[model samples]
Target: MNLLDPDQKHRLFWLLQAGGWAGWALSFYLGATVWGDPPDNYGFYVPIIAAVGMALTLGLRWAYRLTWDMRFVARVLPFLLGSYFAGVLWMVARTFIFFSLFPEQKAAFGIESSAEFYSYLEGAISAAWVMFGWSALYFGIKYYILLQDAKARALTAASVANEAQLKMLRYQLNPHFLFNTLNAISTLVLDKDTNLASDMINKLSRFLRHSLETDPMTQITVDQEVAALKLYLDIEQVRFGSRLEVLFSINPEVKHALVPSLILQPLVENAIKYGISQSVKGGAIGISAHKDGDDLQLIISDNGPGLDFSQGITPKGSGVGLENCRERLKALYGRSQSLKLGPTLPHGLTVTINIPFSQEA
Candidate 1:
């Protein structure tokens, strides 16, 4: 049946090799023993020769894979051609080599070209068909093996996709979070200062608008997300005033680069909560983005309480924000991307996000 599957292919091959050798050797022994053939008839050389020929077929598919148009016909066509050639070579070479290697076997099988002088032409014609059958079986198994391998790969990809979809559904953003934040803004205005509350509301509106309007499939440009983050900081500044300040050193190339929706929102929120809020005088939050080969490197660092002391700085909430972002990244990009939170150059918290360019930023 299907032979190409990674598991089945090798198993099939070993089975074929072992079976073929056993069958061929048994048949030779039976015929020779029944006919009172010479002792040389039971030599292992014949089976070894046949096994080597079958091994050649295994590599044929790989050689064709590199050359083919990736179509079934194209890939199999070359392999078939190679299989035919290899089979013929195996048959012809093995017959001559083994016959010559042991002069006694040539006489035992009644196949000595030296003794025949083309006298057994009728028998030779029949023997040719027998060799052809062996060759055909070898190639047929390889063809089956390749098909099985393709199906296995497809199944693996589908399983991975299914898992990712489950994760995405589980972590899908909650609209209720926005509603709650809106209610917080309303309370801030009534129970707190109106001007500061107004600024916060305005910033919150921009952030909500950006999040709601972002293209779900094609990623939003990094610059757009950063611009939205700036608005968020502006509003938070109104609330924190002298307690919060932000500095950005962003690469121009990545501004238009693609990034997932609201990639920076919650991370910045976490930074503010732990970094500046914990500091007595409130320190600065630094944001930077750059290109690293095929990936975009984003660093968000804040001067706040450090983590574990030895590693550097720590954020306030033990990093629920970074974990959420990490979950989202795995859902979207799997292992193709990464998000890491650690200490910055100074005694502060730093969050690093690696976005792949091939995944479009």
Candidate 2:
């Protein structure tokens, strides 16, 4: 029932216009009945006066519409002059009909024919004030509708920008990971390990197919995301062989909880590249997810050489992935999500993420 909604503007305008004139006619009839000696045909005259006024004002509406885009100050004189002239026209029409219907009212007042011009002038002034009021109301409503339209456009533009930013951040990770996997496959091919290279290529194909099919702007359930991760891990396992180990400790209660699509891939990639691959005895990566009251908490940890902030050193290529994850989370959840990097129990790095717990419908 939003009358001001842009879709309903035309219907609302006509309804208000008819209703306003009907009220004006009713008030005129009631006033004449209470005080003045109304003629037997006064009801007929009232409607004619109202119809003439409505028709003249409709023309004024057309004129005002043409000036809608003008500056407010520039429009003032036009509105005033237009309303006054329309009012004079309406007054002339009403007077002709009134005197024609009941000529005796002129003689009842004992007014001379010479004074008719003065009476018409007085009536025109009153009609002008009425037109001025209508003009003010028309402008008020037009401005309100314009303001609402501006706000709606601003919100739509903001939403579009937000979606584009999220898509950019999400898509950037795919190419970074793709180049690494392709290089690995290349290495295996050069080493003449045809069997391993073939298997890695198959797994990489399935992973990429899934990645392409899922939209970057969508959220997937924890279980589905973990399934995608396993596909990725299959390819990585081929490259690292026995050197890479992965452990998943997912709570069944939170398996249906939702997270951004492909949210964990870059984090796992970082662990594999900077932690496990850096060690002679390649390390194990542990990923766990659980519900923490109203939040979903995910932790990815590795038992490898941890970051040494004391020496102001960080793993190469770590920032891009971590920062990408951080930005995506911020864009999706605003201030309600967090990503923190810290040391694991003994000698590794752990990335912890906290996001609002929401389940798929």
Candidate 3:
């Protein structure tokens, strides 16, 4: 409803046009009456002149629509020339009205004499400038709205694509994790450990149920991520039992900080796979998180044989968990988030993720 808003430019344009033409009519009336140029007329013709100017400009506004296609000179040039002629026609009509009203008065700016044509043409030239300015404003507003619409559509498409990618990455974890868990359960069954296999199956069901309940694109708190990771670690604990030593040093201040749903599960799994599973003694793994300025840093490190790569890149394995996490973070936060793999202390690997700290998704 704000008249000053660019979105309401059309309404503002009409209001300004009405006011401008009204001012022009009043100026004309004052010049005619005070100077006694048109036989001392009252303000009867002022309203008519204002109405005519408004109508003439409204017509020009309609004609200006075709002038936008500047590439086709044959089409655009005619509208430009016609607009100027329309202004001349408006002046001619006003001159005739004035001459008819004051028969005995001088006709210096009227079409009564061929000599007065120059004076009429001068008024037409001034009116042409007004039409030109109106056209410029109209085109400006039209193009601005068009550009805004285009940007909105592009942003919407990008958002939908990002969401689709996040969903794909989230679902990718299910089959991979399920296959590995089922293989472990099968090994326990082959060894005639029915009680341990039953427990693993129960833990796996709970983890899968939790994953299905939570939306892939929706973000969860660090505490929720930790809870999910605990469920995953519990399943691995059943398999590794005495060997898997897990530790959590989470900051209470960052418990509610937003993180992608099930983000920590893959990182913890990766830690156990490459760290605990590879070692004979099966070293300890640490999961910690804290708020660092405007960012939240999540770390998953384990005491095991680190990567052999000199550049410290976690090479893509048969499991696409790390790659999926990286791509998901990229889609969610663009370049604002990061995932880095580096050697932890003297030995072992550490996966550190830096993401913006927020309480909401």
Candidate 4:
């Protein structure tokens, strides 16, 4: 198992084994020297003992990586008994070979039993402790690394989702504006209002130029978005002159706050199409921007019919304009930012937008 896959049942199995070996080397000086309250006489054999224990763990980890159901008491129960027997076997073999070669230091076994039997049991228990310590450390480190990787992946996914939403908003903007301007041009040609048509065309060209020029990642100042909206309003006024009026009340501190480009135009367009166009007396669109604690709030209201929740429509809001704006807000700032639609004070429609703000802005 490649320990890197989080979804795998036995992820980090091999990684833990490698880490186990490393920990054993650190704790016992690679088994070249024994450690305890009273140092052993044969400290020089530490490396050999450490090496054998680590090798066994490495081999066993590969052979019997526990499955989902085997990870409980059943797996834990047999490990100690099996290790005890294995340690005793290895210890006896080493004791026999060493004592036969060097008859002196026969006292090294310390047990009345034959040197082979004594060494076998002693070495086994010591090796078992080393294996246990390292295995636990290895799994601890693996768990930590996995947690960090998961957080990084979640952050990356959120960033990608935001970029996708902005692209969707860009798609909504281009076609929506083009159709309206073309319809205006058609009306101008039919009425022969050549001068107004030329002016509208110029303003539309400038608005598009400003929008397409900016980098998508950069947060533009609220002033810039408002300027783009004004340019668009100028063009629309030529076609809807005497039918549209715009009133703006902006707080000085909020002017330099940042927002996505063209954020306000969609709301204003909704006002014009749904309110002013329908009323015989025409209507006024009021825009206000102010700071409320850590939030930057921008509101636009028009004296028109409010949203019809049952029908799922509002003054041209059923199209991509307002919905695209909502999607962009959700994507960029998530729930930290919000847009709300409701009835205006004197019987019109209002859209309120609240976004996080920086003191410098």
Candidate 5:
């Protein structure tokens, strides 16, 4: 639809030109043959006239383009008027050629004197309609193409803005994540637990390196996501010891399913922050992935006091981890993906995500 898109515009131009001109020629041929008793030579002359008109319109198409480029209104009106005047001249030339080729046909149309040539010019009024029709078509197509180009540009700008926002949200996780981990390491150092602090630091380095190497926009397999989550949990396990129990019941068939990289991390982080970390005896966190028809379903849940939505109280109070996850999912999948929060059995919080099942990242 875009005029700047050469292949689409070029194809449409040829189709309309061929169809319009061919219809004009066929209508003329039928009108003369079926409605009147004309000379047999018209069989040859009529097609020639149609060919000439089509060729002339091609030139007018170029003139229209030039007119469109003119900035001054004064120049535009004069150029268009000049093109219409040229169309009248073209009819004059066509009439002369027809009569000169078959002088015998002049008598048939009742042309007997020089003064009578003016009568032949009267038919030029009909040719004027054809010329005006070509002009209308040219302008109409150009207007439509301009609108399509504008729409395409607008969509491109919106896509760029969404990408920038997604990057900002993804990077936001880094500083927040680093602050908490470093604080834990500092606590260990203060307690004189050098060996545990050293282990946590090593695991933290590996987790940060993995996160940095992958682009925020890129997707990864569920298996890769689980491995990253385990590295993250290992660092936390050093802090919580046997208090933090991690369980994963991922379906083997769904392990290769594609998902946004680090998408599950924020969900798991939320579980730890609001569920496991708040409990005296700590809690167990469960992660699962399965294929449901054409969708990939992922769930992260914990065994801690869940939110009471019946009382209109949801534990998500501008939580950066949960909010980041939600925004990232929206950016990636628009309306096709989903994120849901609910209570788990007995008493716990659960986060569920659904995205289109695909093998490619």
Candidate 6:
């Protein structure tokens, strides 16, 4: 199925070679019949000439292949000389075949003597032009193919880099979350709350397991991503207890919409860390998703201290998580996706994400 495969390329080359020569023979025959006086057995002669031209060009192809890696300037001389010689050889073969097929025509033209090579001169010049045309077309096609190959390589490299960047961003969340969770667990252990500490460790294990199992390069359904988010939130819930409140308002229609794995985790973590933890009476975190025209709109907001742009664009302690989400979205969807931060209601920060809505087949 891959036309670029070596065997397929060879097959394609032969197909083009056979087709081009066949077309040339047909065109030559038609032009002679319609635009000029037809010679005896001319139909037979044209095919022979076409076949000879194809054979000669095959030699030109071999020669050109040898110089394929050479610079343009270096290739020019070989192309010119090879085409010229091939053209002259083609004409020589055509003249011999023509004379053999219609012996009377040579006598009628008063060129019975083989020593006088002038008879082949005009034909050779015309044949050289034909070969030159073929050579030009061949090189043009080769240049186009090389350009396509280069473009394919560049795209592949970009895809690899994009995946690496996404993985780096994705994996960054784990250690950041893990460090915070472990610190919380350590505090509980120091306070002699073994029961609470054990429960937190169990939740942390499940969250880490899910995180490690999921591939950053793969996408998960909104429902699946939310489930994973809950695993992380479960750990935080244990730590926060009644001090933290979580809410979900996911639309049923968009539940199965595909999104990058753990895309919302860092955002939610930022909300909890910077928003709820900052307040004496911890604020409620709201997560919602719905279809917005052609896009899936996901919003995570917190009723904690809102961002102060006077400080800078990034909220204090929220830059890494927000920037990670932003870069991952850009890597996944380029400009087709967007993440925006704004004030929520009377207080706190709201992050909105818009991505093209898609589902698995």
Return the clash pairs for model 3, or none: none
Query: Of models 3 and 6, which has the larger TM-score?
Result: 6
- Would you give me the overall lDDT of model 6? 0.88
Candidate 1 overall Cα lDDT vs. reference?
0.67
Error of 5 at 203 (Å): 1.9
Highest TM-score against the true fold, candidate: 6
TM-score-superior candidate, 5 or 6: 6
Write one digit per residue (lDDT tens) for candidate 3, span 179-265.
889999999999999999999999999999999999997899999999998999899999999999999999999999999999888
Residue 160 error for model 5, in Å? 1.2
Which runs in model 6 stand beyond 4 Å of their true positions? Answer: 1-3, 36-42, 107-117, 309-318
Worst 10 residues of 6 by lDDT: 309-318
Query: Which regions of candidate 3 deviate over 4 angstroms?
Result: 1-50, 61-75, 97-118, 309-319
Q: In model 2, which runs have C-alpha deviations exceeding 4 angstroms?
A: 1-12, 26-43, 104-117, 120-124, 309-318
Note the residue pairs that clash in candidate 4.
Answer: 3-12, 31-46, 31-47, 32-46, 32-47, 91-120, 92-120
Alpha-carbon local distance difference test for all models: 0.67, 0.88, 0.81, 0.71, 0.84, 0.88
In candidate 6, the residue pairs with backbone N, CA or C atoms under 3 Å apart (3 or more residues apart, or in different chains) clash, namely: none
Q: Give the CA lDDT, 0 to 100, for residue 283 in model 3.
A: 84
Candidate 6's displacement at residue 114, Å, is 4.5
Q: Is candidate 1 or candidate 6 better by lDDT?
A: 6
Compose the digit string of candidate 4's lDDT tens values, residues 1-361. 1234555535455455556555654665534444433234444454565456666655544433552147566655545554554455445544554456544646554545666555555555565554455445544554576676777787777668777768777657878888988899889978998988888889889988887897665678878778888888998888778878899898888888888777888888878888888888888999999997799998999987666645554443566788978888877788989888877866788999999985432
Residue-wise C-alpha lDDT for candidate 5, range 1-361, written one tens digit per residue: 2227788788889899888888987888889788987666776777777777778777877666666767768546734675576578668767887887788888887989887988778756567777777777777787788888898888778878988988999889889889989999999999999999999999999999999998987888999999998989999999899889999999999988899888888888878888899998999999999998899999999988878867766555358998898889889999989888888998898888899999864
TM-score for every candidate vs. truth? 0.52, 0.84, 0.82, 0.72, 0.83, 0.91
Q: Could you tell me which 10 consecutive residues in candidate 4 have the lowest summed lDDT?
A: 30-39
Between 2 and 4, whose TM-score is larger? 2
Best of the two (1, 2) by lDDT: 2
Q: What's the TM for model 3?
A: 0.82
